[model samples]
Target: MTTTPRIAIIGAGPAGLLCARVLQLRGIEVTVYDADTAVDSRDPGGTLDLHADSGQIALEDAGLLAAFSELARPEGQAKSRLDQHGTVLSSFVPEEGDLAAPEIDRGQLRIMLDQHVRPATVRWGHKLLSATSLGGGQHRVEFANGHSATVDLLIGADGAWSRVRPLLSEAVPQYSGVSFLDVRFDEVDRRHPGIAALVGDGHVFANDGDGRAIIAQRNSEGRVRGYLGLRTELDWAASAGVDLADTASVRRYLLAEYAGWAPELLPLITDSDGEYVNRPIHTLPAPLTWRHRPGVTLIGDAAHLMSPFGGFGANLAMLDGAELARAIAEEPSTDAAITRYESVMLPRSGELAVQANQAIARFFAPGQAPAPDHEAEHRRYQEGAAAYRR
Candidate 1:
């Protein structure tokens, strides 16, 4: 007789939540532990696109694709690349009925996924403190809230700094020498007309070819979010006298750094509405892997964290969750399930992680021509997306 293992998943992000949902549908007992005090504890920042094969497949597996299609903005797939002077170097507007990779606000996607999972499936606010082996292929999971449980299988979907990763792999994410100063503009068409036009439908990219760039995306509401990216030290903001709390100072610093940039692009930096958030980019060394352990495994960023350049992170994470759930459901034994899951996930994510890191460096290459071939670059991304869909 096959014994079902007691499963604990550490995270409530899309990956963890979807994994739980899939497992539950198969009548498997799985609990997701997350640090968030509640579902709305934090703003799930930015937007994401789900490739048809990876992320979309995962949603299909969980029976959330129909719901997601209702919430997703298919028109938000429009994207453009511009020079420092706000010249549209290249643009892509999807043909009608194109659903290759529809864009969705991260928050909305979370809400959709959250709706499908069982109530109490996620133990919200239960921050993982540690996971200790109890021998006999059993483990104890302790939470910061003083709660504990023993499980026969544990999956770490806890993201970049996963507390559960130390039990399986020694690799930690390292700085990628780039920092993004996150800023937002609200009611864009009404409050910032020029910036709205500059951004257009989907996404806008303004790169100076010297490691300074602006990446902005339009969200569901009238809100637009962006990041002023720079190739600098991890402590660039703190060491360079840029106070995140002081919006005025932050804007001045960015303006000065981008002094020669076109006047039309000024609103992207000047018309900020709130405190600027400093995000230092980090990634695990590419092609990372771990020897299979008995009862512990990782998924998503916990397994392979990479820059967002390749736009593969979210889709890959969802794919990992879906595939892992299927592996567990079909395999004769838990160990066999895990082995099958990692065999596919590790290699797939590792390849994409390495590609993402390379893409970052190439996007922000130094001494780039003033008018880079954005059309070619956009085509490459489209091709890559198509391949990923397969």
Candidate 2:
């Protein structure tokens, strides 16, 4: 612990980037490797709300909160809950200038995080293959294309199928019995007016009161992303003759399942502006932990992956990055730092994972009850509506 340690982070994701950025600011040298060919190799995913206590704090620690605010959409916090018939059950509109949990497109957030890190800090296309412990608190990292690096510390931020995880735990990601068809529309205000009106200012969550669900969120620049969710086997689409590559066929297949829903919600699937892609939800087992090993650790989805049902995935990842970086920068010994990081992070993430898994199950549960606090929320909404009317 007397000498400076060479840290290697396997992933250029939000967690990995923020971790490396914080370390750099503290005069620590770190290298980040990612499988991505470039920053914009593909759409990073959907819109995400950076919670104040977690993701926002991470940006503040990394000196990027001001920059984040410039790109964030505060109005995107507007949320509406709906039933299968597309009737708004309740709505929550944020006060003007509320920043408690503003939303940003995932791609834009990634780009903002990327801009803050030092140039060449991330080596793209360095797809991780394996990590071998060299003993005496050292390890070697191997990449897919014959690249390798030996470092004093290795951090796994590589996500669900992390190559760096096996060195720390025997756990692997498991499918959560739900899948989604990701669809998006561009120039939504002009091209899809009805859908835009349905989505309103921010996001919409419409449940069938059974197992099916739809989540659509408004991203920056009038782009809206929608997920058509179903609880089914991993291969259900393939076996059900849903050909993802054929737009018309995919639309027909999805519409068949949603036949009884409101006509207003049909465009979310039929009017998708791009090709539909399938995403099977996956997560690590809840209440997971591993004995600490010197010179190795994990953060984000690499550690405690869970269902997006709880909407805590990205927030937890960024929080993990910021807290772990702080521990390393302050603790006197590497062992002490890892211990401190795990002590707080493990229990916290494990509990959230359990809650997230439960939320996912409840979302798919037959005839599930409204959220426990829905009655209170409904009253608040009624009061707000009356105030607006007055």
* Model 2 clashing-pair count: 0
Q: What stretches of model 2 exceed 4 Å from their correct place?
A: 371-390
Please state the error at residue 141 of candidate 1 in Å: 0.7
Please estimate how well model 1 matches the true structure, expressed as its whole-model Cα lDDT.
Answer: 0.86
Q: Can you give the lDDT of residue 313 in candidate 1?
A: 95
TM-score list, all predictions: 0.94, 0.94
Candidate 1 lDDT over residue span 1-390, tens digit each: 078899999998989988998998888989899999887789788999887758888888898888998878877878888878877877788778877678899998887788788988889999999999787667899998999999999999999999989988899999998889888889999998887887777889889888899999988888899999999888776788988788888888899899899998877888877678888999999999999888888888899999998578998998899889988899987788989999999988999899899888887888553333434544555576567556
Residue pairs with backbone atoms closer than 3 Å in model 2 (clashes):
none
Per-candidate Cα lDDT values, in order, are 0.86, 0.87
Predicted candidate 2 versus true structure: per-residue lDDT over 169-252, tens digit per residue: 999999999999999999999999998998888889888977798889998888899999998999987899878789988888
